[model samples]
Target: MYQGYLKYKTVIAELDSAIQLRINIVLFLASVYLVLQTSVGFKNPTYGGAPKRLPEKINCSASNRGFI
Candidate 1:
């Protein structure tokens, strides 16, 4: 009976250690993913292309009022 109890305890300990290791790995991966996403956003503010803007001087007088 004592030997059986010892074996059970050992198995439980191994399982607990495995679970902790898995959790640590998942946390590490999540942190890495967040860092990469943040870096990408900072590196490229506009994902599509440069912003469009009106020319300094417009040939049309009515268009100068900013009616667009």
Candidate 2:
């Protein structure tokens, strides 16, 4: 939330420089985790599964993916 970011800024500003450094390190790690989590893709868009691999293994006729 926007409020949460503002609150974090205020709190970090009040911390001693040493503690602020530690908090910033944690914030950086958390941001990286959030980015990786959000950027990840899935095999099935509607219901996630193993990611599609190189040279897709979907078994189907040449013209249609659903053909047997």
Candidate 3:
């Protein structure tokens, strides 16, 4: 009975350690994915995978003259 108990404890400990290692790996991968996703989003506002230029600034001074 003592030997069986020791074997069972070791098995449980090994399984627990394996599970923890897998969880850590998954969390690390998820963090890396999130970082990459955010970086890609920052590169393109339109989500079209191509970097686009910002809209040209309006010439408010010139347009206001027309209204005046």
Candidate 4:
């Protein structure tokens, strides 16, 4: 595998800048689409049938001072 990579290293380096930019743009768009899908899933109430419940007591104690 190392030898194969070494052989193609120069070929990879010689790729046109325009091609690299297009590849990068495609990857960025893909990541953005994935994030949007995830956020939409979270916001869609139809996905999770049950609503989450909050705890009755709120704890804002200082752990370092041994308070709870």
The CA lDDT of each predicted structure is 0.78, 0.69, 0.81, 0.72
lDDT of 1 at 57: 73
lDDT score of model 4? 0.72
Residues 1-68 of candidate 2 have per-residue lDDT tens digits of 99999999888777767797899999999988666555653533433344545797766676676444
Q: What's model 3's lDDT at 51? A: 58
- Candidate 1 TM-score, C-alpha based: 0.60
Lowest-scoring 10 consecutive residues by lDDT in candidate 2?
41-50
Please report the candidate that would top lDDT against the real structure. 3
Q: Report the Cα lDDT for residue 39, model 2.
A: 61
Error of 2 at 25 (Å): 0.6
Return the lDDT, model 4, position 27: 100
| Residues 1-68 of candidate 4: C-alpha lDDT, one tens digit per residue | 99999879867776766688999999999988777766665667554434557677755569745773
Ranking by TM-score: 3, 1, 4, 2
Q: Give TM-scores for every candidate, taking all chains together and pairing residue i with residue i.
A: 0.60, 0.37, 0.61, 0.39
Query: What would you estimate as the lDDT of candidate 1?
Result: 0.78
Candidate 4 error regions (>4 Å)? 1-15, 42-68
Q: State the weakest 10-residue window (summed lDDT) of model 3.
A: 42-51
Residue 29 in model 1: lDDT? 100
How far does residue 53 in candidate 4 sit from its true spot (Å)? Answer: 12
Off-target runs (Cα >4 Å) in candidate 3 are 42-68
RMSD of 1: 6.8
Which portions of model 1 show Cα errors greater than 4 Å?
Answer: 42-68
**lDDT-sorted candidate list, best first:** 3, 1, 4, 2
